[model samples]
Target: MNDFKSLKPISVYSTKQAVDDGYLIQVDQKISQEAGIRYPVYLTRAVWDKYVEVPEGMEGHQDQSGRLWDVLFMFAFFGRKETSSHLLFKLRVHLPNTDNWEHNEKVAERSNRLLREVTLKALVTAQDFDDPSPAIFIMKPFED
Candidate 1:
C-alpha cells in the first residue's frame, strides 16, 4: 500500500541553483542582443525580484520556456492577480555600454510605449550559466 508518511518531499529553489539551471538565459540573451550586447555572456538580472521594490500594483510575470525559451520575452508587472486588471508592465533595457543616455532615451521613446509611465532602467549583470548543459527555470507570474 502507498503510505503518505513515506512519500518523498519536493525540493525548494535557490538563486545560485537558478543561475546554473539557465533560468533567464534566453530572455537575457535576447534582451542583451536588443540592448546590443553579445550572447552567451553572463550578467545578473537587475531590479530583480530579490532586490527591486515592486511597486504597489506591480508584479513579475516570469517566462517558462522549457527547452525552447530562446524565443520568449521576460515581462514584468505591477498590480493585482487579474488578467484584465490595469497595472504596469516593467521592462528593463540596457543602455549602450558606454555613457550614452541621450541615444538610449531616444531609443526607448521609439521602441517601447511602456517607457512612459511603466518605469524602466538599464543596468549590468545577468548571471550566465557556466555549465554547458541547457537547463530551465519554471517561470510564472508573481502572484500575491
Candidate 2:
C-alpha cells in the first residue's frame, strides 16, 4: 500500500546522460544526419528564454573528447495562458563548437537549438482560451 499524504520520492537528472532518453535525436529532425558535418534539414529554437534557475552545478558541461552541449534547463511555459500545457519547451545552450571548434558550431548550435524548439504552431489568443482548461503546467518532478 502507498501513503496518501506526507509522501515524497527521490529524483535524479543529468544532461550528460541525455542521450539515454533518445529524445534528443529522435525529437529533432535536424540532428537526423549520419555525417556530423551535414544537416540537410533546418533547425528550430525557442523564441524567448525559458527557465526559473539552472541550479548550482547543473549548467553546461564538456566531455572528455570535448563534445559538449549542456542542458541549460528545460522550461515548460505557455504562450496562451497561465494554465496551458503542451510540448512547448525551452533550453539554454553553449556547444563546444559554438563558434570556433573542430565542428561547425553553427550547425551544432542550430541542431541543439532545434531540439528545444517545437514544430512551430499557431499561437492562441486570449479569446481562444478554453476555460475549465484545468490550468495546465509542467515540471519534470519525476524520473523514469
Per-prediction count of colliding residue pairs?
A: 12, 1
What does candidate 2's lDDT look like per residue over 78-137, in tens digits? Answer: 232434334343333342222222211123245463222222222122211233322212
Residues 1-144 of candidate 1: C-alpha lDDT, one tens digit per residue: 879988765965544665677443234566535534343333224323222323333344333222122212232222223243223234343322334233113344656533322232322223323444332222222321
Best of the candidates, lDDT = 1
> Candidate 2, overall lDDT?
0.26
Q: CA lDDT of each candidate?
A: 0.33, 0.26
TM-score of 1: 0.22
Candidate 1 Cα errors over 4 Å, as ranges: 1-16, 20-26, 41-46, 50-54, 58-144
lDDT, candidate 2, at 50: 19
What is the alpha-carbon lDDT of model 1 when measured against the actual structure? 0.33
lDDT of 2 at 11: 55
